[model samples]
Target: MRMYEIVLDGELTSDLPATAGPVGRRQEGGSTVLSVPAAGRDALEEVLGLLESLGIGITAMSEVEAPA
Candidate 1:
């Protein structure tokens, strides 16, 4: 499995509805961040889409994977 942590733009989790993301939640200066560990691109995108539906911009994205 792979790990994908999205540092979203503006408030992410707080403003995000219940159906937006997974169980991780954190907050940065002006943006709320959610850490969806061990998630694939498709899964991440689906979460991102849910965020978009709430009118949140995806500021940045980072990916990591377990040692093979």
Candidate 2:
């Protein structure tokens, strides 16, 4: 699975749904950063959709490169 870093506009009031898979969350200033792992693009899209449905706003998203 590929790793992605998603930056939300603000801190999430609750943890991400289990469907999002194992995720890491941290607060960066006023924004919340989430480390999400997905099998592919489609899976990542699904996670994004789920976040939207939960009223979370994404400010930025990018794949995380693995260390050599």
Candidate 3:
């Protein structure tokens, strides 16, 4: 599994995706930061598609290092 930080151009409500993985969200300036962990490539793609369907602009996306 890998952790990802999906930074969006706008703030999102908690109920964005009911089937999404455990998400941690917060607003940073004018953007919303979503911390999502994916089990594999399929899962990651699903998240990306969902974001696209919602028409959310992705400001940034990067893998997060696992905690030691």
> Highest lDDT among the candidates is held by which one?
2
Instruction: Give me candidate 2's TM-score against the actual structure.
Output: 0.74
lDDT of each: 0.65, 0.78, 0.76
> Residue 58 of candidate 3: its Cα lDDT?
95
Report per-prediction Cα RMSD to one decimal: 3.8, 2.4, 2.2
Tens digits of per-residue lDDT, candidate 1, 3-68, equal 676777776434445554554667888876666656545556678888777677778877766345
List the pairs of residues colliding in candidate 3: none
Question: How close is every model to the real structure, measured as TM-score?
Answer: 0.62, 0.74, 0.75
* Candidate with more favorable, higher TM-score: 1 or 2: 2
Predict model 2's lDDT versus the native: 0.78
Error of 1 at 12 (Å): 3.2
In model 2, where do residues sit more than 4 Å from their true spots?
38-43, 66-68
Q: On lDDT, who's better, 1 or 2?
A: 2
Please give the distance, in angstroms, between residue 48's alpha carbon in candidate 3 and its true position after superposition. Answer: 1.1
